[model samples]
Target: MDNYKFILSGGGTGGHIYPAIAIANELKKRYPNAEFLFVGAKDRMEMEKVPEAGYKIEGLWITGLQRKLTLKNLMFPFKLISSLLRARKIVSQFKPNAVIGTGGFASGPLLKIASGRKVPCLLQEQNSYAGVTNKLLKDAVAKICVAYDGMEKFFPAHKIVKTGNPVREDLIALTGNKKEALSFFELQENKQTLVVLGGSLGARRINKLIEKKIGFFKEAGLQIIWQCGKLYFEEYKKYNSDTVKVMAFINKMNYAYASADVIISRAGAGSVSELSIVGKPVVFIPSPNVAEDHQTKNAMALVNNNAAILVKEKDLDADFDTVFSGLIASKEKQEEISKNIKNMALPNATKDIVDQIEILLKK
Candidate 1:
């Protein structure tokens, strides 16, 4: 049909937000005139991220309940009721052909109402361990697109499809541009480069580990492009010298991936998926604060196959230096890790996820 309508909900972190946008972009490519609406938590990153991706977004008065007994937790019931009501209103007004959820606080209410209305619904779960929101909506959604195997435990076996996680197309395309990449980063071709990512807000422990290794890295003739993240830029910005490039953010990840010989990063699903395509020897330090410790679970999928390394935050003090040093010094180890991780990449994940959506629409 020339005019198709779809409602998608996912937000909070870039992990949840980027996948939803990627799916939308794919759908738009197939049905150029399709109308897409994104529902996200008001003031969450998706509110801005979705629109920036050129899709219309509606925000719900929703927030995830905290683990601690706080005022926000007390208001959880009221917020849920309000969000459900708002979701119902949006579903009725939009009359979408189908609804999609990528797993976040806002998606819970949106998918629940859409499913209750007998609208076709789909979910894309990026993690090895399912999120609570996705688990709750398992029975309601018509399809579950997953990145890892053995998700049948959390989702209906018949409904689950292993489509992998959608990643930025641009980053994936830059895999072969080594010379161009090094030029963009202003680095010489002879020196091995180490790329560090601590997310947009920075990882406290990763930052400290990098700081401690500053002299070691320079002495070893390794160039550094450290994304210190916005939160800690003030404290770490002074490390920006000829050998060390400390950035608050790196908007051009394609260049970063192209230039890197080795990478150190948090084990978030989005980071893992992107790194798979980048195919460099990566050291993953999974954050302990995430729900169900999913970051480590995400990293283990790579480590189990010898695709990458996992250095738990708790063990970083004792293990980071040793693990990082070993990976850097051994050319064979770097090449082997790079080759394995690249094999795990699903470069067409964005397209594959939209393929599922199209199938659901036809059904």
Candidate 2:
């Protein structure tokens, strides 16, 4: 009679979608017979990603409220009402023992309705700075799972659990094999390697800076592993040479993290969490395009602690050359950054989050 049902909701970007899937996967591992359903925004990335993760998903006609004046903002009320009704229906039909939301556009409505119906809901907040949606639903959520410290500024202090983020299991597995990783990338055992990632979609500023500074990397004699993302792949692929490996998507992220002597990346919450676990010297370039500038706050949490370096997007073009070159040339600085950031790793976050769910479900 194992009929424990769980509904997991999150979407809009890989940042939100992946964490929800990681939690769902953890639940599956612990409760093999549990039925799981995902709720995400219609026409969003989650519609495709959730199915790919081997779960059933229902989409709501939900969108984020516009920040600027537009016709879309005029339709906001109708979409909100429709989505709330749809979410309530899904919650009633699923009859979930417990529901989980990783913050996103769909999560606000889905968790709100589930909480209104007396279903226990868990909110996973990934950033150091909480988003408006998560902040609005904080009181309605049964418990809050967070990656950063001092989130009491946003959530009820008693309900907060510092469970770090649940990253891809593969990235955690990278901790063991450094030598195997260098060989896998066909990198020389002794040379310093630098890994540059602009996320899966790529950051325009980071890509442009790297594209224009190829000779600097060559002059420094540093080996490069660049993940330029899908958007700028074609334009940047020509920069690939014997010393530099360029890719649109890196299927084997564990190898990339393990092989790197240093990493330059955008400071998305997920990337920050994974980088912390990988324990590499990292330079963060937080994207200016994100809502509330949460990415900068996410990186600053670490930078303030001397765990990593930050290069503002606008400053990357002018300042990155000297800063990057100096860091790569200093082994002491690299080791110090690596050791400091590794202190932030939460390797057991998946287990902790699942444990929280189990505790709430049993109650």
Candidate 3:
């Protein structure tokens, strides 16, 4: 029992993969003798990211079905069947103590197979709206760790544990002072800093909005830290100046979060969780392109609680100037929001999740 083996399956994006990695890391801390293995779709981000996180991962021959009719859509049945067979083989060979899934198509077959083999299964649903894989596997998993309220609409009340989402360890405790953070980014200490994040690929609409508002920000005497993503770096790089630091990515996010007077971000589950912990006043422009518009739902959960402000893509032109300007002008509003958002953060999320896994192991 001391040498417990756990299999974690989730991928396609960082939202899914990072949570799995975080949970695995926590499990490693609690049970140093435990064995951890990750299962993800072949050729997906998880294949590379999992190894980078120092864990072994196996790839399943699987991918999500496309909305429009295409060759990949037509091949869905073959892929699902192949993935299921391979997953069953993995379950049989590894004989995991428990299977943990973080909700992506890659997790579906693996969790299903592991549960069928009578292995204890747990799922971590990061978003307010459950993913298709998690929903389908809900009946199979012994417990479901969720981030938002009203998830009983998607999951069984008895199985659900409101543990929030696992965030990067570095973000949990921001040890750097604002002075240190500002120096790290080479920004002026006297100027208020506006940090913009649009995920790893760069959001087109967000990039455009930031570009359009550059003049307004400069007039307001705000320094900016813009992470425009790798895809849009070249096009936005010309705008970089002494006051505006534009980059493909920020390796030191703790510094960025510490240095921010305010934050403008996309409402990904991971980002929301991190921002809540960062406790900064934020404006969330949820991406409308995601499945079921879950990003909007994620943002609304905070907005409804007065923890953050949300401006939809369509309403940006009319609302952005007024909303952002008002928030910036009032330190009272900023403090109120910062306090509310920090209250919503579950700083012990990763540990809480591992506690559930320990319960399964004890059983």
Candidate 4:
């Protein structure tokens, strides 16, 4: 077998895809000749995103089972059987030295099959609370790389590796020159900057709350950089003003993180990782729609430590303005949150994860 022939599996959202890509990138740097393949759900974002990152990907006819009674749940058994068979075929063909899962619907089947074949496999759980897929495959995986603590409540203690989530390298080393970031966004440097992000697909509640309080932001002397996400961009783009910049996506995320004095964001694991490194005071509005309410758990991990503020999605309309205005008014609180969160940043997470991967592969 080759020293490093790796297969990565993850998808459904950028939260899963980006970390899979980050791990792939780190593996490539360490073993230049390493061959990498990605397995993702057929219609998910990773099919397109993996290729864009210069990796080959195979699609499996797999999806998450619905929570309630639906036609999709009726087909769950058939889909699971088909995905297992397909995943086995991919593993048999690739003959990988190791397989890595970043936690998504696709990763569940792919890693399960790989483990069944006696192949070394690792699973990265990005949330404070484990998803059903990861939990189901917990015993099969050789290692469980996790971002949050107290996860021993779910996985085998020996297999757990407490590596913080991997973030984009460019964002990790962000040198936030307020003047430069403001200039790039074409905003005046005199005003305090507030950056709002609602993940890649956008949050409906967050979008509505922002719309209702656009006047409040302007009144607070805050310049805004809002990423409305692709789904709502068309409808919300019209709200863009001289003081507020609206985008479907922001490619230069480093600048966005650097420019802002305060941030309002969803508390996904990837967002938390980036925010920790950026060291900015943030208000985390965890999406209630996510599986197991893990986003709230992620936010609470920081909030309990005084590293961030958590505002529930349901409370955004009523409490967002009051909570946000309080932070903007108090410089002391902002500085304290920023310093505490930065202390929690794991800057060498990629290196740490890669190190563990290499050790497992060697065995």
Candidate 1 is scored at a TM of 0.97
Clashing pairs in 1: none
Residue 245, model 2, lDDT: 90
lDDT of each: 0.91, 0.90, 0.95, 0.91
Candidate 3: where is the Cα deviation over 4 Å? none
Q: Which tens-of-lDDT digit does each residue in 1-363 have in candidate 2?
A: 356899999889998999999999989988889999999999999999989989999999988888899999999899999999999899888899999999888998889988998888899999999988899999998899999999999999999999999999987877647689878777787778889999888888888888788888878888888999999999999988778899998888888887888899999999999999999999999999888899999999999988999999888767888888779878899888889999989989989999999988888
Write one digit per residue (lDDT tens) for candidate 1, span 38-146.
Answer: 9999989999888888999999999988989999999999999999999999999999998999999999999999999999999999999999999999999899999
Off by over 4 Å in 4: 1-3
Report the CA-based lDDT of candidate 3 relative to the real structure. Answer: 0.95
* Clashing residue pairs, backbone N/CA/C < 3 A, model 4: none
Please give the distance, in angstroms, between residue 331's alpha carbon in candidate 2 and its true position after superposition.
Answer: 1.3
Question: Judged by lDDT, which candidate is best?
Answer: 3
Name the lDDT of candidate 1: 0.91
What TM-score would every model get versus the actual structure?
0.97, 0.97, 0.99, 0.96
TM-score of 2: 0.97
Local error of candidate 4 at residue 176 (angstroms)? 3.7
Residue range with the least summed lDDT across 10 consecutive positions in model 2: 170-179
